[model samples]
Target: MVEVADDRYATGSGASPPLHAPRPEVEVVTAAKRTRRQREAATVITADARCTPVLVRAAIVGKARMPRAALEILAPNGAVIGNVALPNTSADFDLHQRFWLVGDPTPGSVVAIVAEGGRQIILPGSRLRSGPAEGQDWSGVACRMLGWERRVAPTDAPAGFQAVFSSDHPTIDGPGFTKAVRRFRTAAVTIPLVFFGFCFPFLFVIPRLVQSGTSTLSLLVLPVLGGGLMTMWSAHCRREVAAQAELVEGGAARWGKEIAFTQSYWASMRKPSAAWDGPMPAAAV
Candidate 1:
């Protein structure tokens, strides 16, 4: 019989560890770093607006520095109607007096502000309809900025566009108030259902406990059912809110990239051609 060398029992300076030896585990963690532009984008202070059928006016406030910022008015189909240059200053400016025409006055129109460094802000638009405007039969869209009067000065919008910002504006109109009312109505309906659901399990559990005159495993069922229902409802509400917030955030980011691309295209288009180079002579070699 031939004897094979046993490396597991070998002890020497060059000996390697056994194959069955356990190796230590290490966890590596990496964190993403945000650029200056991303930091500026995430710090949007607030964007407020007052919309009318023909005109859309808005104000944006922030703490970042945006040079040569311009507001671009977009049509319902995402076509750029025009862009108005904003003052070159910090991001804390207002557009109280500035307003633009819809040209077509179609619904679903939106507004965006793009700056030199690709910083952009998008504001939601209001729905339009036929309503009373300054004692005249006019059909237009109107949306008032929430808490605008308390935060900023009264809007100096033109006469025809003034009614949208006042109390005369339609109660059921504008996405601002419409969304608020919808959420309120939802809460009003769901609160009662949740309360009844939590109590519903108790009604049967208590009656059985009283009749039996002894504690049983069925007692755990009421608490478990009630807790599960509440947890599910709370999770649903949280997911809804988070989804809406993410939609707004994703839209803003996408719009910013588009604006940056458009700006670069225009810049390249306007760039002057370099001096023409003379033709090289092939015989010089």
Candidate 2:
């Protein structure tokens, strides 16, 4: 294999890994001179507003750099118009916003969005090209990046062509609430059964046996019952531990993928890793 020297690929603490590098630069002729543009977009001005009814195609380009877990579109002057979400596995998730498209959208229009770091990015249309990054042809069917802009139908839009504003902020899960809920729901079924089966002999079953003058039989049954209950509870606890482990493992996997995706999104745009949180200047329409 041929070794290649890469300088732009290295960076700081939060720098994305190598495989997550941004798309390479494209050299296109302008005024008989070479101008290189990377095929990626970032979010800008994630506000909500009213917009004129216009139909168009679009795709989400980034999930990180998104102002919120969801993204909304704004007009050139910063008016809310539409919204959409980064697509998940099954559902067509959407952000909430109200704004309008002034013209028929094509391949290179800049869509306004609010990125994760609370700054704005006026994402350019050119970032989305025909093929995958390696193909060097970004001419694929247009689909908005997640946590970015989205297309909307005039009829499906809010009254007056305005859209609502929404987002899944604080991007990370809160206070382990989800984990607690899962533990509670699961234990609801297992805990009661364990107690009745294992500890009830010392409370009710033994007393009943003594009152009935069946102490010997009680002695024989209680031990066996107690042992079986203990075994079942132990098994249940083991399963719970395994399930919790799987959950933690899954979360780590998701976080890794998100980090990778974040890097790829900006790298595709040819932006430095710090740009995610750096200042973004306003776009001149």
Candidate 3:
């Protein structure tokens, strides 16, 4: 069997072993093919669109401690797909509806593999099971090979939508007045420039008027005028900042509402009797 250095090569006993000492030419060709397959990938909506699908490029199969583990892809399938490795842990796959496999995958298809734990692995078409019986569930066998039970409901569909709870909501600061305060704080930095602009021009003009025989009246009056200008500018900045803060609050509320709606929508579309536990037929070449 062709072997990868270190942990990648399989070492345990199995019902069927990989091809021993594959021909050099065949190995080279397979490696090239695997490289090419990793680049082709697509994200699919599965489980009645309850679960978001992620594609990947490659995978690694090995044991973590005494339990089996897998590292696979969840991105663009290509000549060399990237994969994430997950260790086996105590998690019930059956509860998560992890029994389905993409049936009859073409030469380049995305495959999702659930590990013993809650962790999942996605791999490209190059690493899939080859020469399987028609209409057989490869996901079950893959789970068993990883030392896990084939626990899946035949017709239990996932709930339709996901919820956006306040606890998990994304926020910059607090709600209500605090949000306004944050915006005002940001504006404070820029408002000073406006005040300075008026002050500088008045300082130059007032001194010229004093020297031009105005008995320095312009100098005295300019300070009061500049002060008034500064006050007005500060008010303007505060108002603008507060307006921006209102936008932030409104936006957050809108996002939260959308997420809640998505959850409810998915929940309503669930089909409790739809069975995905059946065998996934062998992929086509």
**Candidate maximizing lDDT:** 2
The clash count of every prediction, one per candidate, is 1, 49, 30
- Candidate 2 lDDT by residue in tens digits, 169-200: 21123233234324433443355576567666
RMSD of each: 26.1, 20.0, 22.4
Model 1 agreement with the true structure over 132-173: per-residue lDDT tens digits: 112101101101121111222257768766554366543333
- Give the TM-score of each candidate: 0.23, 0.21, 0.21
As for lDDT, the candidate ahead, 2 or 3, is 2
For candidate 1, the TM-score is 0.23
Model 1's C-alpha root-mean-square deviation from the true structure amounts to 26.1
Model 1 clash pairs are 128-141
Return the candidate ranking by lDDT, descending: 2, 3, 1
Q: What is the alpha-carbon lDDT for the whole of candidate 3?
A: 0.32
Candidate 3 C-alpha lDDT tens digits along 1-285 = 011123233467444545784321201101122223332321331333122233321112422112223333332232323332222222222223222233233323454442222132222334343332121122233332222332233344543312222334323233643444334433343455666776778776766776778877546765677667656754554554344333433332222322222222222222222112212112210
Measured on C-alpha atoms, candidate 1 has an lDDT of: 0.32
Error (Å) of candidate 1 at residue 196 is 4.3
